[model samples]
Target chain A: MSVLKVAGARKSFDKTQALGGVSLELGAGELLGLLGPNGAGKTTLVRAIAGRVRLDGGTIELFGREITAATNGARAGLGVVPQEIALYPLLTARENLSVWGRLHGVTPGDLAPRITRALDWTALGDRADEPIKRFSGGMKRRLNIACGILHEPRVLLLDEPTVGVDPQSRERIYDMLAELRERGVSLLLTTHQLEEAEAHCQRIVVIDHGKVAAAGTLAELVEATVGAERRVTLTLDRAPDRPLPGFEAGESGVVVRAHVRDVAAEMPGLLGVVRDAGCKVTDVEVRSPSLQSVFIHLTGRELRE
Target chain B: MIPTLLRIAFTTLRRDRVVQMSVFLLPIVFFTIFAAIFRSQTRGVTAGVRAAVVDEDHSEASRRIVAALAEEKGLRVRTAARPEGAPRGAAEVPLDRARALALVKAGDVPVAIVIPAGFGAGFGAFESRAAPIELLSDSSDPVAPQVVSGLLQRIGMTAAPDLFEKLGFSLFERYGGPMTGQQREAMRRWTSSLTDTAPAGPGRAPGRRSAAGDSLSASIVPVRIVDVLGDQKRNPVVALTAAGIAVMFLLFSASSAGGALLDEVESGTLERLLTSRAGMGTILAGKWLYVTLLGVFQVTVMFVWGMAVFQLDLMHHLPGFFIMTFFTAAAAAGFGLVLATLCRTRQQLGGVSTILILSQSAVGGSMFPRFIMSEGLRAIGRFTTFNANALDGYEKVFWREAPLTDLWPQVLVLAILTVVFLAIARALARRWEST
Candidate 1:
C-alpha cells in the first residue's frame, strides 16, 4: 500500500502558477527521488503535504486519510527537513534535537533517550555539547537530518539533504537513510544531484513547468525517452576528410561518435570503418544512456528562462 | 577603475531602500520634531500659566488684585468651576479654599492662589502682622509655580500703589511725631492724586537689574508656598528620570527581541516550526509573550538600579510600579512585533524601529517633561504614542502617591494598544505563513 500520496495538487501565486495538477505517490519503505529544475512544483507539493500551504485544488492523503491545511494530526506522522540549516546556531547539537523532538510531540520522559540515540546515529555524540556554529558543514547537515527524525516519523520529506557536503559525508548520509529504510521508514527526497538519485533511488520522478514530466525506474525512463543504447566514441591521430558511414564528426574533426545496441557485437565492425578511413584509432570508449541523458531529453538543457 | 567603483557604490545605495530612508527621511523627521518644540516658545505660541484663584477676603483691594490678574495676558485665572456632567452654559460655583487646593492636587492647574479673610484689612501694611497670600502648587511642572509667583508680586505693586503710600504716611505720623497740618494735608492730596494715575501695565520691566538672592521681590506680596505632593518624597526627579529612560530603552530592547522572528525566517527555522504541530497563531503568541517578558525584565533592572543608586522609592511603590510595568511592557512588545513584521529584512527593521521609537520618545515626554512641551505636541503624544500614557501612569504611582484605582485609564489604554498592535503584526506576518 502507498504510505503517502499527492493527487491533482494545484496551487497559484497571483499571476504565477506554482503547481498544476501534479500527482505522485510513495510506497512503504520506498526511497523515491523527486528531480526537477528550478521553479518546478517539488517544493510546493512538499509544503502542501506538510500542511503549511492551503492548496487551491488538490487532495493529499497519508495512510489512506485525506489531509488539508487544517489537518493538524496529519502532520504528526510527517517530518520535513528544509533545505537551509534550520537548527539554532547558538544551541548545542543535543539541545537542537531535544527542541525538535518536543515540537514533534515527543514525550518528556522519552526525550532524553531519543536525543542520545539521535546523537549516536548522526555520529555527533562527541561534539553534542558544543555550539553547532563551531561544527563543519558536513556535521551540521547530519545533525539537520537527525533533528527531523527524533520523533521517528513514518514518512519523511527531505529537500536537498546532501547539498553542500563532501563526498564522504554524502556517502554517510545515504548510509543513514538506508538504515532508516531498513527500519520501515518511507522517504520522498528532492534533489538536484541526478547522479546520487540514479545510484540510490528505487524510482525517479521528473517535473517540469509545474507538471510531472516522467516517472518510473531508470530502465523504463531511458527506454521511453532516450532509448536503451550505448554511446561509442573514437579518437584519431589525424582528421578524415571523407564522410564516415554511420558516424558523426566532433568539433575537433579528430574525434568521432556513434550509437550501438550491443557493444560486443558492433565493436569489431566500427573499428574496421575507422581503419578504412585511413585514421589510426588511438582510443575507444563505450557508454550507456544514463539518468542524466534521460533527464536532459525530458527537460531541455537550458536555464530557467 | 575609480569611476566604476563609484558607480557600483551609487547603484548599491539606490537599490537599498533602508539606506535611502536612513539617509534622507530620518533627518527630516527629527528636524521637524525638534524645530516645532523650539519654535513653540520663540514664536509667542506658548500656553499661558493656568492658575485657580480663591478669594475668601471679598474686599475692594482683593477684588482689584483678582481683576488685575484676569487682565494679565500671562496668566489664565479660574475663580469658579462647573461641576462634573454640567452643561456648557451651567452656572459656575465659586471656588473655595478646599476646591482650589483640590485643583492643585488633581493636576487641573499647576498653581492655586488663596487670599485670606483678613488680606484686604491690612492691604499694604509693610511692618504690621497681616494675613499672607497662600500659593498651593504641584511642583512637577517646574514652570507654572515660578511664573505665577513672580506675576503675583508685580500685580500687587502695580494694582494698588496708592494704598502703600497711604500706609507709609500713617507710619511716619506714628513714629516721627505728628506732622504739621499743612504737611499732613499736602501728603493726603498727593496720595489721592496717585490713585487717579494709571498703574504700569503688566509687561516686562525694561533693563531691570535683577539679583539672584533679591528678598525685595518676596516682601512685596507676603506669600507662602505650599507643595501639594508634600516634602517626604526623596529624589522625586530621579524617579521620573528613571521611568523615562527605562521606557525608552524598553522599546529598543523589545524591538531587538522581536527581530528574532525575522532571524528565524531568514534561517528557515520558522518554516520548520510551521511544519510542526504549532500553527502560525501559536508561533506569534509565543513570540509576543517572550518579547513582553524581556521588556519587563529590562525595565525592572533600570528601576532597581535607580532604587539602589538614585534613592528612588521603589519599595514603597512596588505594587503600582509592577502593575504599570506589565502593561507598559505588553504594549511596547506589541509595537516591537509590528515593526519587525512590517519590514522585510533585519536591516530594514533596524532603520524603521529607530526612527519610530525615537520620534515617539521625543513627543511622549521621555526626552523632556511633558509640561515643557507645547500643548499641541502633548496632546499628540497622549493620543498617538503609548509612551505618554505609560509615563503618566508611572508619575501617578511615584510622584503623586496615588492609589490603585487611579491607574485604570492608563491600564485600559495600554491593553487596547496591545491588542491593536498585535493584530496589525499578525496581519503583516501572513506573508511568511505560506507562499
Candidate 2:
C-alpha cells in the first residue's frame, strides 16, 4: 500500500501560485526525492502534506485514508523536518525532543525513553543535556530530524535536510534516513542536491513552474529526456593523421568524440576504427546522461536558479 | 571610505522601518503625550479633593457650616454614612468623631471635620466658651487640608461679625484697665442675653447690634480650626508614582516577551509546532500563559523593589494590591499577544508595541498625575488599562484605603480588556496557521 499520496495539491500566496496541481505517491519504505529549482513549489508541496500550508485545492491521503479537511490530528502520523533548524536554542537536545514528542502526544511515561532513543539514534546522546546553541551545525541538523521522528511517524517529509552540512554529517544524515527507510518509514525529501538524490533516492519527481515536469528513476529520466545514448571520447598520444568514420576530432585535434546507441556494444568496434585511423589511444572515457543534465533538460534552467 | 560609510549609514536608516519609527516617530509621539500632560497640569484643572465632615453638634448652625463647606466647587464631600439602599458590601456609614478620626488615620480621606458641642451657641457671642472645630487631616495630604482650612475661614467670616467684635472689645478692656465687679457682671449679663434675643441698644449688650437693625451680627460664629495632625510624616504621592511607573513598564515587558512568538515563526519552530498534534489554539494559549506569568513576575518584582526603596505600603494593601496586579498583568499579557500576532515580524512588533505602550503610559498618568489632567484628558485616560483602571485601583488601595468592593469598576474594566485582547489575539493568530 502507498504510505503517502498527494493528489493534485494546489496553493497560492497572494499573486504567486506556489503549487499547480502537483501529484506524487510514496510506497512503504520508499524514499521519493522531490527535485525542483528554487521557488518551484517543492517546499510548498511538503508544507501542504504536513498541514502547515492550506491548499487552494487538493486532497492528501495517508495509507489510503483521505485527510482533506482534517486537523493536525489527521497528520499526527506524519513527521516534518523543515529546511530551517526548528529546535529551541535555549533548550537542551533532550529537552527539545521531549517538547516535540509531547506535542505529538507521546505520554509522559513513554516520552523519556523515546527521547533517549532519539538522542542515541542521532549520535547525540552524550551531549543530549547541552543547549542546542552549543551544538555544531551538523549536530543541530541531526537533532532537528530526531525531533520530528521521536513520535515514530509512518511518513516523514524532509525539506533540504542536509543543506549547509559537512560531508561527514551529510553522510550521517543519509545513513539515518536509510535506517528509517529500513523500518518502513516512507520519506519525501525536497532538496537542491541532485547528486544526493541520484545516489540515495529510489525515485525522483521533478517539479517546475508549480507543476510536475517529470517523474521516474535515474535511467528512466535520462532515457526519456536525452535518449539512451552515451558519449565516447578517446584521448590519443598524438594528432590523428586521418579522420575516423562516425567520429570527429575534438579541440587540439588530439581527442575524438563518438556518440553511440550502446557504449558496451559499440566500444570495441569504435576502438578498431581508431586503430585503423592510425591513432594510438592512451585513455578512453564513456559517459552516461546524468540527473543534473536531465533536470536542466526538463526544467530548462539550472537547479539553483 | 568616509563617503562610503556615510552612504551606508543613511541607506540603512532609510531602509529599516523599525529604525525609522524609533528615530522620527517615537520622539514626536512621546513629546505629544508628555506635552498634553504638562499643559493640562499647568492649566490647573480642579479634580475635586475628597473629604468628609463629622457634625457632632448636629445643630442648625453647625449644619449650615457643613452645607456651606459642601458648596465649594473644589471639594467633593462624602458623608460618613452609606446611602440608603446602597448595594451589599458597599455600605459606608457616615462619620462620627471616632470613625472620622479613624478614616483620617487610614488616609482614606485627606481631611475630616468635627463640629464639637456648643459650636452652635458660639455663633451668638464671640466671648462665649465653645468647643473648637477639629480638622483631622492625613499628614500625607497637605494640600487638601489647606484648602479645607481656607473654606472654613470664609464660612466663619460670613456668618459672624459680632463674634469678632466682642473678642476685640474684651481684649481692649483687659489691656486698658481692670474692670470693677459691677462692670464685669453687667458685661456678662449682656453677653448672656445675646443668644436668646438680639441686643437691644448700644451698651445694652457689649458688642451686640440693635434689635431694630439688620446687621451682619444677626448670627455669630466663634469657630476655630485646630490641626489634629501635628508634625506627622507621610508621602502617599511617592507610592502613587511608583505604582504608576511600575504598572506601565510591566505592560511593556509583557509585550516584549510576547515578541517571542514572532521569533518562533522566524525560526520555523511555529511551523513545526503546527505540524504536530497541537493546534493553533493550543500554541497561542501556551504563549499567552507564558506572557501572563512573565507580566505577573515583572510587576511583582517592581512592587517589591518599590516597597524596599520607596517605602510603598504593600503589606497594608495586600488584598487590593494583589487583585489589581493580577488583572493588570492579565490585561497586559493579552495586549502583548494581540500586538505580536498582528505584526508580521519582530521588528514590526517592536516598533508598533513601543508606540502603543508609550502612548498608553503617557496619557494614562504614568508620566503625570491624572488628577492634574484636564477632564477631557482624564476621560481619555480612563479608557487605558493601567492609567484609568489598574493604577487607580492601586492608588485607592495604597493611599485611599478603599475596600475591595469599591474597586469593582476598575476590576471590571481590566477583565473586559483582558477578554477583548485575548479574543483579538486568537483571531489574528489564524494568520500564522495558514500561508
Report clash pairs, candidate 2.
B80-B93, B80-B94, B80-B95, B81-B93, B81-B94, B82-B92, B123-B220
Candidate 1 segments exceeding 4 Å error: A234-256, A271-283, B1-5, B43-45, B56-59, B81-93, B126-131, B175-216
Can you give the TM-score per candidate against the true fold?
0.92, 0.83
- Give each prediction's root-mean-square deviation over alpha carbons: 3.2, 7.1
- Residue B396 in model 2: lDDT: 71
**How would the docking of model 1 be graded?**
medium
True contacts kept of each: 0.83, 0.92
Question: B1-435, model 1: which lDDT tens digit per residue?
Answer: 999999999999999988898899999989998888878756543666789999999986788788888887777789998764479898989988888887787677888999889998787776347688888988888778787788777777767767777777788878888889999889888877777773543533323313311445756667878888746788887888888988899899889989999999999999999888777788889999998988888888888999899888899999999999999999999999999899888999999999999899988989988877777888999998888999999988998888889899999999999999999999998998866
**lDDT digits (tens) for residues A151-232 of candidate 2:** 8998999999999999999999999999999988999999989999999999999999899999989888988898778889
A-chain TM-score of every model: 0.95, 0.95
